[model samples]
Every structure is written in structure tokens, then in C-alpha cells.
Target: MSVAAVLEKDYFTDYSILLDPYEYFDAMRAIGPVCEMPATGALLVTGFKEAVEVLRNNVDFSSINSTVGAGVPLPFEPNGSDISEQLEQHRDFYVGGDLVVTFDDGRHRALRSIANKLFTPSRLKQNQEYIHQLAKTMVQQAVMQGGCDLVNDIATPFVTLVIADLLGVPAEDREKFREVIDNAPPPGNLDQSDAPTENSPLVFMGTYFFQYLMDRKSSPKADVLTELAQATYPDGSEADLLDMVKLATFMFGAGQDTSAKLLSNAMKYIVDIPGLQAQLRADPKLIGNFLEEVLRLEGSTKATTRVARKDTQIGERKVSAGTRVLVALAAANRDPMRWPKPNTFILNRPKIAEHVAFGRGVHTCVGAPLARTEVRIILEHFLAATREIGLCESNHGSANARKFNYEASFIIRGLSELFITLAAN
Candidate 1:
């Protein structure tokens, strides 16, 4: 299809494109590395090089709109060649504008430093046993049931409790956290008309974390929460209570949601791809490479948004200041210029880490290491406990005409539910 034909459709809201965006991305890349979406006037970065350029250059591109994207209108009108002052003045108008993902430069650096405490090597090492035990128990239960809904039955609860333990959340509050997050719709859902302005699960999580941190500050305890509560900025000054709250809650919500979605995506590929499960089973080491391939092909985060802080160029395309830029991570990962036969999933693909599945530059997913460790451990347990794994024929139909449902969200790519039948080893 011609680029004009592709641009004719609003890739953000169009339901058909949301279901399977690969074809749409392919069409966009055919035009150029960066093409303007006439519908929203957002520049779509479909080429890997262009995506890297935008993601790495925080000087010219601001992440103020990272969470909301182009779907939401800027609070203030763009003036002259720079809207930096305007963005600051109206920052609160942007949805999730207070989030760490939306912060830039010094603010981002300071907040990220405090949040980094939760993912320290020693902290994750401490949580490793809990992750393994949970995965083993969950896999064993699925084996006994013969079939399971992978999203709810396994991934959601598993990742939630893991994060709870890592964050030092009280045992009594873990189940409530799980229930609130599980019931909340994933971000960027197309069906959510008020997505741009609506309060997310982060709001609720933030409330709890706010109270936890406040209490920790007043009554110090020997826990991660106390550490976070007292964490100082790089300047050795105390961080704001609200900023810490935002970082903590954002971590809890983003960490679990993205990780859970990733697990479901991995399982979908494992059962759908012929001989994949057996191959991973034979050589457990291959599971790491297999997971990378899955992430490259269908990572949980499909795309991320950035706004140009100043007039700039992404490849050959000129972007005006304040223009919204949609860095298509999924599309860029599959760019033929970077990956040979980008659409096909090749195990042990060379330089697999090069893919921007977890993003690039400073804003890379903070919980990435923990995510990789937990998902890999769970997959290992499931594969070890099961002799065979296949999709539920009744729910997904025959192999020839398989059917699956994906979350109706532009930003997130994940299965709403995955039904799988397993044979215990």
C-alpha cells in the first residue's frame, strides 16, 4: 500500500490496525524512516536508526508526552521554535505528566536514582527464591488442571507478588494490590474514551505508597520502603514526598503490567510456534534466546511517545518544535535495515539485545533485569513440569484457523487471555 493510503487510517484509534499493526507498520516504513501521520500530525518513527536517534536525543526531544502520546491535545499552544517554557507551565495538564517516564534531564535522573534502590542486585537476589517458589507452585497447579488461563491464573498474580516482595509491601496488602491492578484496564485501551484524563491504577497504588512512605519517614524501619522513604537526590538533598510516591507507584504498576503481558506474549509464541516448546525443553539455555526473539517480535510495549522540544530532524524528515513523535519500537525492531527478514522469528538471532524492546537511552525500563529473571524462571518451571503444551483447541480453534484476542490498547501489545492445555511430565 502507498504511504498516503496508510496515512489515511488513524493508526491510533482504528480497531483493525490495533489488532494486527505489523502490516500497518510495514506500510509506514515503505514511505521512509520517519513519516508524518496526517491524521494526528505525529511523526511515526518506523526505522530503527530513526527511532534510536529520537530516543537518544533528549536534548531536542522531550518525553513530556511519553505516556499520553498524540491522542491527547497539548494544553498550551506551541509558540515560536521552542515550547519548553509552555510545557513546564502546563505540565500538570498532561496526563501522567508527573510520572518518572514523563520527566526529563535532571528531574528524571534524580527520581530514577531513588527508584533504582528497589532493583539493586542484592534486592533482586533476595527475591529470587520467592520468584522460583511461586513459579513452581503456579506451574504445578496448571499441570494439575490440564488447562489454564495464562494471564490471570499465572502471570498477573505471579509478577504482582514478586514486585510486592521486592518493594517491601506489607503481606496483608499484596492481595488488594493484585485485585486493584488486575481489574484496572491496561493503559492506552482504545475503548477508553477518557484514557487521556482518567485516573489509572497508578493513582490508587500511589495513594497506598504515599501512606507507606510517610509512615516510613516518621517511624523508620529496616525495610526497602524505609530506604526509599529516606533516599536522597544526587545533590544529597531530600527528595520530595510526592515525587517519591510517583516513582514508587509507577514502578509497582508499570513493572507488573508490562511483565505480566510479556509472559502471556511469550507463552502464546511457545504454544503457537511448531516445535518451539520442544526445542526450548531440550536445551534450557535456548530459553533465554527464545525469550529475546519473542520480545523482538512481540514485546509488551508496542510504541512509546515523545514530543520534540525543539526543531529537529529524524533522518531526512524535519520535525517542528512541539511536534509529537511516536517511536514505534515494535516496527523499528522489525526494520529490515536492522534485522534480516525482520518479520520472521529466528532463535539465537545475532545481537538480539540490540532490539529496543525495553527501549534505549536513559529511560530504559527500570525493572528490566527483574523482569527477565522472573519470566525466564517461570518459563523454565513450566517447560520442566510439562511434557507437552498446546493451545486449547476449543477456545482458539484448529491450528489452521487459530483465533486469539489481544488487549485493545495502542501502547501495549498482549493477549487478553491465553488458554493452554498441558500434559504433566
Candidate 2:
């Protein structure tokens, strides 16, 4: 059956779907592997196989079409090879826009290849220790407060600190970095907004990042930025400073946003489910499988946009050139065809590790290792420090009460506020 005939309703713009998307996603998936959204004129691929096909076939489903300045109309066309010009256009459209998630050109490939090296095993190991230390400190501080919003008090700050470390912000200036982030609205808050205004927090972040890049270039310190400044593309050419700055800026903000969401979602499951918290506390080794299950059930990303470079068939749906496709990773992870009893969070599911939480193929998130390390370290510390963790009935009422709220976002799945109390062992 044609996707249009199989699906009749518009799913993309329906805000109600964000409240509880799994059921609706399941319904959509049942229609077929691919369904067309008439509202946005985009095809939504829900099946695991079809989603992987689109992600892997980057040549056919090009990501370059969905640049940083997508959707909103702009005076200056965003198509250009000039890195500076691209940044200027992106700035005018939306601040803190980076090429890492956008550009799929050769330059992007080169940048990704170079950036992937930064997360080497040694660096990741070092960061893991640091994250454990930081998590212990955060958990201790939260315990002292008796009860705290885990999203704000723990996951948010923990992810931000890790981002600061990765960005090579100085030890003395780390607090300043936190201050900047705290002052700004949460990332992805304005993703669904009509257009980015001049005074958005994104703009503030972009401005600060530009200056930070300049500072790093001038001082040539022993940080990631310093390394980026002196690095070269895969070719024998020096990487553009603006390119490096933009990549760094994107990674800093986007990394924190997604990692915090992933960690928050994982913590929510740990606290919400019965016996799960105690089980993890008893055998912390289960934390890895627990996280993998969380990624499979409630991944950080809901979907990603791609544009068809040429007329192609995604599953049975024939997508024309220039057609926008939204690959639903969350739905794909839960696809019954790929996962047996997909809804159930089996801690030791043999194939759980194959879930595309960080995506697949060349465009896979480079920060996955860092995010995993952050989540693992934080959970280890949280479980070790606390004998029991429970939702704060005072702050969030009871689990059955209408006290908790997830962020109403199209792309991310995480709690806006998760108030929990950790009893120190």
C-alpha cells in the first residue's frame, strides 16, 4: 500500500503526540515502514530497517539540504563553500548553529574524522574518572539538600561540566561557563519556535564561543580548542578557524543537551520502576545493560531530518528528490520486527547494544562515547552513594499523581524536572 493511503492523519505537528508518543508511533509503524506527514510534507520512516537504510545511504538521503538555517526563510542563501560566509548566514538565521550536525559535504567528513580522534580511549578513560569524581560531588551536594530536582541539580550540571571539560575551558573559568549556561534558557527549548530572534540564549552562547575560540587561538593552551586550532583537514590543507570554532560551539551545547536528556531518562526509569533501583544498587555491573535498555526504550533523540538527493524508495514509499524525511530512531528502536517484546525493558537483551541511540553510519554522533561515560559514571556514583532513591512526593507528588512532566519537544525525550531524594548509605 502507498504510504499516503496507509496513513491518513498528520502526525508531525500534533502536539498531543509529544505527551505520549509511543502508542501513536506504534500505530504509525503498523501502517507500514514509511508514512507521509501531510502537514510538513515529509516522510516519516518508523521501521528499523528502513531507518537504517536512510541513515546509511547518506549519498541518496543527503543531510546537506537540512543546514543550520533550515525551514525559516532567510535573505542570504545558506549555500556556499566559504566557512565564514556560512557562519554569517547561520548567525543571521539562528545563533550557535554549527555544521557538525548539518553539513554532509567533504569538509564535514574531514571534520568528523579529525574530531573522532579527540575521544580516544585514553581521553575517554580520563574523562570517565573525572566524571565519576564530579558525579560523586554532585550526588553528595544533592543528598545534603535532602531532596533536589535531579534534572536541574544533577544531570544538567553534570552534563554541562563534562562539556566544559571537553571544550577545554580553563579550570578557573569553569564556573564562569556554568554561569553562562545557567543564565541561558535550556537548549532545544526554541527548536520548534518560528524563528530565532536576535536576543535568544543561542546567540549569547554563539558570541561567547566566538570569543573563546579567539582566546584559545591567542594563548595556544593545552586544551581541545588549542588542538583544533593547530589541526588540519584530511587533505593537506589547514582547517579554517571558524570551522573549528563552529564545530566546538556545536559540540559544547548540543552535547550537554542530549547527554543530560539521556541521563535524565535513564534516572527516571531507575527511580520510577519497582525493584529496579535496588537491583542496580546490588549489582552495579548491570548499569551498562540498564543504560542500553533505556536507550532502546527512551532514547535521547526522537528523530532526525534528512532530504532526498534523488528519487528513491524508502521501504515501499517512493520519495522524490528534495523530499524531506524524518527518521524516527525512537520508533525504530522499538520496532517489533527488530526487537522481540520491544516495549519491555529487558536488562540483558542480547541485541540491546545494537540500538541506534547514537545513530548509525557516518553521521553517527561522535560524542556517544563521552555521553556513555558520563551516564555510566554518574549512575555508578549515584547508586554507590545512595542506598535507596525515590521520587520526592512533596515536590513531584506520587508517581501516579500528575506531578511529573516531560519536555514537549519533537526531537528530545527527557524530563523537564525530576525531583528525587537519595538516601545516603
- Whole-model lDDT values for every prediction: 0.86, 0.73
* Model 2 Cα lDDT, one tens digit per residue, 195-296: 321224444466666777777777887667777877788886888877876777667767887788888889888888889989998898999889989999
Score residue 277 of candidate 2 by CA lDDT: 86
TM-score of 1: 0.97
lDDT of 1: 0.86
Task: Give a tens-digit lDDT track for model 1, residues 58-119.
Answer: 88888998777766667778987887878878888888889999999899999888777778
User: Per the 3 Å backbone cut-off, how many clashing residue pairs does candidate 1 have?
Assistant: 0
Best by TM-score: 1
Q: In model 2, what lDDT does residue 265 have?
A: 88
Candidate 2: regions farther than 4 A off: 1-12, 65-98, 171-193, 196-203, 400-403
